[model samples]
Target: MFRNRQEAGRRLAAALASFRKERPVILALPRGGVPVASEVADSLGAPLDLVLVRKIGVPGQPEFAMGAVAEGAPLVTLRNEPVVHALGIADSDFEAVRDRELIEIERRRRAYLGDRPRVDVAGRVAILVDDGIATGMTMRAAGRATALQRPSRVVVAAPVASSEIAADLRREFDKVVCLEECDDLFAIGVHYADFSQVGDEDVRRILSHHATVAG
Candidate 1:
């Protein structure tokens, strides 16, 4: 098991050392991802940014993701049609949840980012970082959304993830970098000894630190 997010980040940075020359931008999924991405950005001497995406959970079963929405200039949404159809989720119902998530996304963007101009991903390799992946819905949505920015390539990097999910992500991202992939992965926290909850303040602090370092 990884010691913590910092250790995981350092290991992940080592694995991605070859990309230092490419100068890829590190786009982290906020809250948990910020801490991990902070170390990566510093190690690679790359600009740090966010790929805000939220999973649209199934009604009554919030753990079951039906789709995900990514915040951007126009926003990007990806739905699992099979899951939605099988569950008989109506358009109105789906819209309601998506709308709610959008609001939360705006709130987070404001809280964590404020008015900072987003890093340009155009023609540059965009590396998406997170603590781990389970269903892979959030990362998938974030990838598709980042694609809209016309990055030269999209790479998803994480410390731990399910082997099956990592394979699935390969189709969406140009490259997937996962330090530990377990077929029988249970929870993301299981791999981290200190998987404490990451708060907005923590995210803000990390981002601020990266910004200062980059400058």
Candidate 2:
């Protein structure tokens, strides 16, 4: 297995080596996806950007994501009714958590992207890259939001993902590419050796590095 995000990204880049000539755009789902996406972008010589989305977590158990939020056009919210009911999460609680997450999403967009107008996606192939997928809520949100931009194809690429969620996501996107799929995928970190928290500052630093390289 890949040791860390960089190693995983390198392996993933090799798997996707054929895409280089097509010059597809890579949109990373920050703040964790930035590092991995950077490596993919460098390997493929493609421009990198961010697809902003927020996790709509259940109240109290903040890590349990029931859905997600994204800016631009109609916001995408994927509801797992069975999970919500089983978890006893009320509609009010979901709405409250969604509001909070949306606020943070806006702050992230402002802080990380600032004045860098979002690149147009119409007729372009938008590859949504994430470090890994557990609940798949955030990636679903990214896919839905990218749908609004009317991209020719939306590809979901991750180093690892829960098999069930990957199958679910396959129905929504043109292609779902995952390096590893496990049935017992309880957490995204379980598959990584150095699964550290990626901070906003780290994202900013990587973005800056990308900018310098582009310039």
Candidate 3:
């Protein structure tokens, strides 16, 4: 596991050095991905921006992702059929929570981005970074959504991932670069030593610094 996100990002940047000349745009999922993406952007001399996706959590157990909301030009929602079937979650129930989370996502986007233009990925490489991958639902949704924006390719980068999900992810993205995959994995937080909750303020600071650096 990484000592922290910085070390993880540095290592990831090394692996992605070949893309430096491509001027690939680094789009990180907010909160957790910010630190890692900053390091990659710094190394690649590319711009960093947030891909604000909200996981529609199951009721009572908010940790279980029922689906995800992909924040995009038209926006997109992908549902987890198995989770819905197993939980017997009705359309009304799912819609209720999805709408609530979207509100929070919008608030965060406004806070971190304001009127700042987002990174243009059309015909350019789009790399999606996250602290780690668990269910891969959000990352999967994010990758597919990014592809629709006409990015030439989509790459999912993470410090670690569960082996089972890693295989499935390979089928979805053009490329997957996970540092390691553990078979006995339980959760993403367990892999990190400094697994602190990255707050909205942290995201805002990262975005501000990224803008200055890119300029």
Candidate 4:
């Protein structure tokens, strides 16, 4: 098991060392992703940014994601069509949840980033970082939203992910960097010794530190 988010971030940074010259922007999916992306930005001397994405949970089973919404001018939403159809989820109901997630996304963006201008990913590589992937719905939304920004390439990086989910992510991102992919993946915490819940304050602190360093 990995020691903690910091250790995971350092290892992930090493795996992505080749991209230092490319100067890829590190877009973290907060609040867990902030610490991981902070290390990457520091190691690569790249700008740190947020790519907020929220999962659309099934009505009764909140852990089972039916879709997700990603931040953008025109928000990006990815639906797990088969699951929705199987559950007989109405479009109206789905739209309602998506709209709620959009509000949360905006709230997080402001909380974590304040009024900082978003980093332009146009014609540059955009690396999306998260602590880990479970169902992969959130990252799928993030990738689609990032793609709309016209980045030259989109790379998804995480410390660990479900082997099956990683394969699905490969189709969405230009590259997927996952250190460990296990078939028996249960919870992301299972792979880390200190998988504490990351809070909004922690995210803000990390972003502040990055800004100070960049300045």
Candidate with maximal TM-score? 3
Clash pairs for candidate 2: none
Model 1 regions lying over 4 Å from their true place: 213-215
TM-scores, all candidates, are 0.95, 0.94, 0.96, 0.95
Tell me the deviation in Å of residue 76 in model 3: 1.6
Q: State candidate 2's TM-score.
A: 0.94
Instruction: For candidate 1, list the clashing residue pairs, or say none.
Output: none
Q: What is the per-residue lDDT of model 3 for residues 76-164, given as tens digits with 9 covering 90 to 100?
A: 88899999999999999999999998898889878998999887889999999998888888898888789888988898988888888
Q: Over the stretch 1-215, how does candidate 4's per-residue lDDT look in tens digits? A: 88999999999999999999997999999888889999999999998989999999988787789999998878888899999999999999899988888788878877887887778899999999999998899998998999999999999999999999999889767999999999978789989999999999999888888775442
Question: After superposing candidate 3, which stretches have Cα over 4 Å from the reference?
Answer: 213-215
Model 4 misplaced stretches (Cα beyond 4 Å): 212-215
Give the alpha carbon lDDT tens digit for every residue of 62-84 in model 2: 78777788776777777767779
lDDT of 3 at 37: 90
Task: Write model 1 residue lDDT over 1-215, tens digit each, in one string.
Answer: 88999999999999998999997999999878888998999999999999989999998887788999999767888788999999999999998999999999999989989998889899999999999998888999899899999999999999999999999999767999999999987789989999999999999888888876452
Whole-model lDDT per candidate: 0.91, 0.84, 0.87, 0.90
Q: Model 4 TM-score?
A: 0.95
lDDT of 3 at 157: 89
